[model samples]
Target: MRQDTEGLLVRLESDKDGILSIDRYGFIQGINPVMAAMLGYGASELEDKPVRLLLPDMDEDLQGDEWRAFFDSRIERHHDHLLEFVSAEGSLIRLDVQMFTGDGLQGGMTLLCRDMTLHLGAQESVFRQREQLSAIYTHATDAILLVDRRGYIENSNPVASELLGLSHRRDGPFFIDDVLRIKNHHDAWVYPFSQALIQERPVVVTDDIQLVLPGRSAIPVSVTASPVRDRSNRITGCVIVLRTTSESRRVSTRLSWHESHDPLTQLANRRQIENEIFRAIDHAHIDDTTHIFLYIDLHNFSVINETCGHGAGDELLRQLGRMLQEEMVNQDVVARIGNDEFAILLWDRQPEAVMDEAERILQRITAFSIPWRNRRLKVGASIGVELINADSTSEIDVLLSAGAACAAAKAAGRNKINYPSPERDSPSRASLSQWTVRISEALDENRFVVYCQPIVPVKAQRDTQHYEVLVRMVDPAGNIISPGKFIPVAETSGLIDDIDRWVFERLFTTLEALPSEVRTGYSFSVNLSGGTISDEKFRDYVVNRFAGSSLEPGLIQFEITETAAVSHFESALAFINALKAYGCAFSLDDFGSGQSSFNYLKQLPVDYLKIDGSFVRRMEVGEVEYSMVSTINHLAHIMGLATIAECVENQSQMALLEEIGVDYVQGFLISTPVPLNTLF
Candidate 1:
């Protein structure tokens, strides 16, 4: 027995687990080399030392009987537990410990400990990796799903639920067959997920594949299926990804169509027609062939457009385009070139045939009518024919000849055909017409800004400020343009009302943002075009804006030229009376520039008159100019109205205006126009 006991002790000393024995008084009676080395000490140094040196948590005041009770308690309560110890080098050691007390060799206690720090650290690292993978799955852009070995859905991301139309509240052990159904080009089932699982490789389908839901339309997608493998190289499941391609395809097709076709009429547009003309010119030069180009302008079209709405005009144009297309041959091209205008090109036709075709188009347009509301609207066309022969110049010359011929036809009579020579048909006004696009673009891009020049009272006035609000446009190159360059074109193209609205909206909105005292103290003089003053809608818009503004009624004063007021006399009077009833003011600008300025003054209810700059600038030199200014000022005072002299440049002009008793003076002598932002 003694020999057996000695062999057991030798075996225990060589074991990997650390072992120690302590007496009831808490002294280390015996310790194996393993335990001593773990604590960074030798067996001789620790064997006789108190156990409390290693276990700092143990109380040092315990006596022999107290130590006996403590050992007993540790054996019962802390068996097979985790505890911490301080090494001799002041490092931490975490261990899984077991205690034995009754059969201990020293009649105290025995400890067996295994280090657990490395094992627990490895577990925490694996947990973090799983969390990162879960985040990727949940937030991926493409729809993704994970399947199990038995073909059942183990998990899915949020995109998968949305793409497949699955409800999160549903209870299920969902199978891959029920959740993901794919169809090939022939409407036959395609099991990419099952194939990926069986072959242990990725399967991708980019075309002619659709995902079918139970009650919704099938979605076109590019699908990819990849097998999920374990560490042991065995297939466990598959990942399915779906990316949509429907919207991209639709956008591409729409863009391709709009490149050559008009959005309103679905016919060839001007760009397409120009390309065809170039091709025709090239063919004519090579083979000496002839092509006939016809420019068609519809008459009385604006009558329907303005009387009935623009929708009616658009419908009429569409109907006319269809009729014109019916008259063309296979190689012929028909296109809408402008508002209420269409062009047709007939290839390889003689001069007589072209004339007959133009006549037929005239009769066809005159006969066609469209029904709107309770009435039928009919229109006539004036056709201009240009024969393109081998001697025909460039495409631009051909278009110019056609346009000039059309102008001659309109000048003669309605529903007529004319082929006037380009040189005699009145030079092309295209240069002036191009300003329409520039002005429209400036308004759309918000490139216009307000500028103001002070209107100083010649004599000292109290609590009153006045300025003339001017408009300037900023081009794409950052250059400022004066109104004289574009205003004539805007008036001719019926765009002056739009310009007026733009200026009024910007000025009124800015004024509303200022303090009440500032807004009420100043009066702004805004210019009004003849078209704007005649428009009932513009008048209503002004009234509504004034009703909503916080400014005083007298804050905005309208300035109109004598010619504008005289041209639209009745409408101007009504417009003035409507706003004048609302406590607004009006000024007659360029008073003596018109032929009958004084004759119309008796009928006009104005508060101020501005002498024309032409007379004001030469007043210091010419007696006639000076006499005109004095007479106008005397007449304005007699009618109980104030007079403002414009173009007052030098002290001589200012002194002349003061001698004439003018109420206000505005010119370069006072100040040039500055941006509104700076003054405010």
Candidate 2:
């Protein structure tokens, strides 16, 4: 009988199902090998032990009573119960148990226990995974939500709660439709979500969706939704992620403004105007619309700058900008393209309408008044309107043509609005281009001539006097162009340095050509531009050119304008002192024109002070002018320097200058600015 029972225990141990038996008192009467092994114990050891010892506390009390009660009934044949057990090593295990009551046996109960450990382990693993996933979802930066098929929130992360500004009370589950009120908040994005759910496909929504927060601050968000699916490929719900794009949109708008607008006046800059014109032309191409560009320039702005000051000019410009902004329509693009010029682009407007607008703008600008330092200053603008045809191709050409029209308007008169005319469309100044070509050719052919004007001593105070060297251009037509005309042109074209060098070389040649007697008691003063004085190489070249001449350096006085001297003071001081050490005297020309005072006068190392022509021109009749001349002469005398009064056009002016104590006088009254041969 023992051998047979042992064999039965082996068979039970090999079986997948578990078996056990207990008495009515909830004690283990007997247990199969499988049950014992599953509990990590021997069958003999488990026999007669209380079943409550092998079960977890959570199920021991209730399950034991239920098993006893069912066994007592006797009619309840087989009852199933889900039981939780604790192994001998203290690990929790789950079991599905079935109990049977024996017919003849007293206080006997049969329990068929299946392990169910692997299934419970797998369920626990899934629970833990869900917990980890929930943690990650709550901390995600992008707001995430799980919406059911009916557009109601089934589950959501903390990020979603914060993004939607929802309360976190644990009363009940929250619904997306109720909390977000997305239908009322962002109607534009609702369609995409509905479509995604119905079609069971992913969809993106990127409109100007607005979200009204608790404080009524509308936050714009861009939402994207995708359908969630289960293992069977059936749609469970949809997952939506919201991104707050309000800040990004603001940044994008600011970037666009900075790119197309000027920082100073907050108006369209040159690039913006160009883009507007191109866009206007493009629109006109697509439709039968007309476009016009108006180029407006302030007349006599330079005169205002000279007479009042740059501060007044700047205030006027700022006032004009404000006026333009106020008067023009929002659709028009007005821009400040030049120093004192503005451009306006009119789209889809008639030529007459644009002309009327231009006239109105001109009138407004003319009527605008500016408050200067202590007075009210008035100014006017000139407008040039040019129409663009559908066939126009070149933007630069249109702008240039408009500029030419503006120039014509200004030349005609002040406060004039001019349209492009065929007659004026042809070049206005033949002389300008002709002079440019002639000057270029003359520079290349060495046709520039030098003339000298004498700065003679007023009395017999000194034996030697200096002659001011001037340049003249002799064209192929044998006409001499004065320095007043060609010199300005040369300076504008950046050819003044070349012409200056040529003059120096000619002056040296003329000096060499002078007779010994004339050269003995004579000194020549050559005028130099501020640009040439700033050139170190030119300074060195001048020094080298006159190094070995028998004529002493004192006989060649270098005359520079007071403005030029002040601009390049440091270098000019060094150069002049070095040349003075070599016996070359220095003279300050146009002395009173700039802001030179007695302080700068003492600092400058010079032998003569040339009174400005303006002061000298009025010296004969004006007591104030005569007093200015006398004061300069007195100052020069104190500094041990001689004085030259310039622009003495008549005998009276000459006599007045002499009486003012001027050491030298230079004007056409004594003798006109004749050629060097006349002096000889």
Candidate 3:
């Protein structure tokens, strides 16, 4: 029996694992060959070594006296402890050690050790993967939240905290119903979490979510929720994400402005005018109420912008906006729709009432003067009032017709308020439809005609001069329709380019037919619309029209309005430079009409500055008008540019313009816009 026990003890010691025996003093009494090898020592070296020698210095005290005290008090108690040890070669190893007291023949404590390095490495790898996934979850821009089946938030990321304005912490599970605050239709009961949850399917809810902040205003968030599932494919929880769309709301407000207000003035534009007219018509249909559309155009605003800087012009506009706002009824919709035009929508009003309001507005604007630099600039306004029957069918048509009437009033004189006449009533819907059809037919049949208006030199050193070719359309009555009536319609219909091509082709052919004397020393300017300057194809067609003609490239000046030239400056510059290379001279028409006139002039290569008609017609006894004309003439001369004054109505204005050094003049006084053959 003794021999068998000895053999069993020897077998356990040589078992190729780990074993140790300690004395009451916590010193190592015996160690197996495997245990010594694991600690990088021989059995003889480790046999009586203190166990403290195998551990790090910081842990020596922990396993030394304190462990001895613990063993003394609890001898029979078994305990498992993790320990770190430094081997003889200074490598760190982790081990799990079990200590228990034995009371057989040995009568001492036995220690069992397991090399746990591989098990610990596997656990560390799992920890690292969990950390990586958590990092991805925290940094994602999309707001993510985890909620249990009851809609209580379990875990949420930083994005959710930012979007919801809430401090999220891991606590007892929460329900989704409490967070969203959804209630029943009766406003008496709360909805259940199950009602809103669907596993793995996204649900969008665009309700006003109120978020309370720390002593700040409540923010609105748009929330979207989707359900999450477990490995068993059962509905476990949900994920909710939210975004703050305040800026989007602001953009929507501006879109409403784009529909009803002017882009420049931020006031109700022409579209709003039409809307007000229709509203009035609807009210009249039901309640027998009347309304008025007052078209108010600044009379000398063009002169102010052209003579003074456009900054001054803009100041004048803003001043007029304030004045109209002050003078009109509180219910009125005042707007600055055009460059120098305004409108007012008056409800429950008569023509006389509108006229009276118009007079007050005009007086206020005229009386108002803004100090610009060293000068006080004043301007006037013209108004036209049109009373509409509450039951009118075509409200937009009537509003535009009233606008035309206002323009006619301005043409007649400034500071005058004209009421719409019977001629200014809305055209028959059938007539407009017929006109639209006829215009389309005319374009398709190529029935458009080109007429040339001579841009003659006022101080004529020669008899023959250049002419500007204008377009006209012949109607079924054989009467020519002016461009003012149909050009805007064509432009709106995307057919202006075709019309421009036709005009260019016809002008080229007419120049080919003219005798050499008529064609020689005579240049013809053609007006290019804004639609044409940005159009590469239309520009190419213009170039091609002059390709095989008898016209000199320098003589055929392509006239573009200042507003159009400045709109797409880069494209205009490139197109103009290309045309210049082909010997075509360019002119900036309505030179002082736009805001960035001087800047545009410096960038554009043009031969003439066609002074806007506004400045010329206003060049009367006023010192302001005289000073403006003189300044323009001096500037043109300094820039080596010849000037043409438009709307030269009488010899008195003409004589003053000539004295002011205007090189050429064109209007009814010099000559009416005549036909091409009449010049011969």
Candidate 4:
């Protein structure tokens, strides 16, 4: 029995197939003679080494989650696949691998492998015996050639002759390698057929392979070669296949050009420019490189396109593309992304340089005009320059910053170059600066007037009512300007406190003129700003002015924004307490709009929590909004505060708010804000 077991062991070790044992950590524990010989290493040298010494990219795969789970669960697994190994000579060797989980035997695995060259020879032998392949070879679109072992062509198809421009050559005079001219992308000669026949091995040549004719353009094609052998395993000849790639190559070239170039302007397109931006971002991340992205708007280009003909507009766009190309340096890229919208990309360019270039473009555009029929069409340019760096948040953030800066330039009357300051300049901020001067002038001339909107109770049984006082401005031409237009400016420029005082004084005078029954029947609400809340002088001035008037605090409700209140926590707390002591009520306007949490609601002495218009206006159409409104209402009720829904535009929104147990609603549905004189 011992002699029989030893003989069996000897036969197993002597087998041509490879076998190896791997520890739980993928170390080579034991290697059979065949595996050691195949790996070009002695048995003692391979043992106790990492398996990755042969298959470097395979170590992670062997210890992958799925592989680990197989072993931990004690689930036996069998898989047959091809594994590639980098041999000592730095050439890839593919083997048919049969791997299995070792049934948790010491928490390890087993691998069996065989070189696929022998299996391929057998498959080719079977393929050669199939008589049907003869017809297939004759009808195939690719060129096929049969050459004998002595390097003489035996048979050829029509395509094989045509591929090499040898359609007129007889079979006896034309040798396959002599008649064909092949080169690689680098224009170096490549003899895949000759080399394959000499080496008695297969070869595949790709990547810009070309076939040259005597007096025509070189055709792009790929060459594949395989050695043919007889059943006795002797090299007989070779089969060379040629595949023309011109059709696919032509299609690919056209598609690639179209993707990266704008058809209209013949410049880089949006996708291509975006790729440039991505590269710039990657460069910035690596070495803190800075770049500039300029958003350009051809001011009133649309009007020119509409007034003049489309042909005239096309001429102007083409001129603009050419003009920009000539104006920019070699490293700069200009793109037309949409109608009348263009972008300029500059890497590592200074802000001052960008500003100078933008100014030159603007000056040139302002001076240059195109003749359209009998009239000359001219337009200005507004460019917004944003300095991009690693500190500029994200790619989209910087892009939006540039867009806002461009919009601000346009808003500031156009024909200008605007670089975003460290502090961003939004369109609203531009309007704020413009209105600041106008607001000061209006205050000097008393152009500010008061408007009021009625707030109605959601429940019909409740009869309490209040009117919110809103402010408007009258221009020199006597046009009534909406509060929405100037209030943002007032708050931003520290004019809200003055405006608040102006509204307070006007209300007192108006109340005194009205009959007592008018004041007794209804109360009034007024919106206040954070500037007024934190101003001690404004608070004292209001106290003294109101104490002297016939206006009782009970007839007034002061409204403050949630964001403003949170910003001036200490001041807001003191102001609310002082106002409440005077028999007045306070409401937190636009309550849920800011990041301030409802957890602070217990500390704020507010009589009302006004839900923001964004959630209230869309509550009927959005389920999440309805649920949100319901939640805010429930929380407000728990805190013993009434809720008012803003921007209740239609009956559906009204009905939803009422269903949610809201106390009141103030929006256009109930009344549009109008001059106080209209009320009288």
The prediction achieving the highest TM-score against the true structure is 3
lDDT of 2 by residue, 263-378 (tens): 54556777778777777767777785778888897865645665687778776776677778877653666888765778887766786676687787888888787655434577
Q: How many backbone clashes does candidate 1 have?
A: 0
Off by over 4 Å in 1: 1-430, 597-599
Give the per-residue lDDT digits (tens) of candidate 3, residues 1-680: 01222333544644655777777556788888778888888888877767667765334556434655544433233244665667888777767765555444254455666788788889879977985787577555555677877666777665564444343222334455545453223433333235446325666645545444455555455556766778987788776765555766334433544566554454667767766677767777888776777777665565566567678887767666766777765356787766667777776775556667667767887787765653567877777776767546566555555565675686677687777655555454214334555667888877788777666666767554767778889886778889887776565333666777677777777777777766777777888777677788877776676665556656667888886677556557777888887788777788666665575577687778888888888879678767877787788888898888888899899889878878888887866666765655
| RMSD to the hidden true structure, all candidates | 34.5, 35.1, 28.9, 27.6
Q: Single out the weakest 10-residue window by summed lDDT for candidate 3.
A: 1-10
lDDT of 1 by residue, 1-680 (tens): 01222334544755577877777677888888888777888878888788878765567887774765654465466554655677888776767666654543545666766667687679769967975786576556567888888888877765675566552234566888887888989999988888887778999988798888888778787888999889998888888887766876434433544665566665678777877788888889998898999988787775576568789988888777878888887578888987677888888887667767787778888989875654568998888878888866566556656765776787688788986455544433434445667888999998898998889999987476788988898898989999887776676455677888888888889998998866777888889987899889999889888887667888888999886787566667888998896678999999898655465688899999999999999999999999999999999999999999998899999999998899999999999988887776
Residues 5-81 of candidate 4: C-alpha lDDT, one tens digit per residue: 22334445548778777777767888887877776778888788777777734445555334445333322332436
**Which stretches in model 3 have alpha-carbon errors above 4 Å?**
1-254, 306-308, 390-393, 422-447, 451-468, 474-524, 528-552, 559-582, 585-680
Error of 2 at 281 (Å): 18
**C-alpha RMSD between model 4 and the true structure:** 27.6
Q: What is the lDDT of every predicted structure here?
A: 0.77, 0.71, 0.67, 0.73
Model 2, position 533: C-alpha lDDT score:
77
Error of 4 at 77 (Å): 48
Against the true structure, candidate 4 reaches a TM-score of 0.41
Worst 10 residues of 2 by lDDT: 1-10
Q: lDDT: which is higher, 2 or 4?
A: 4
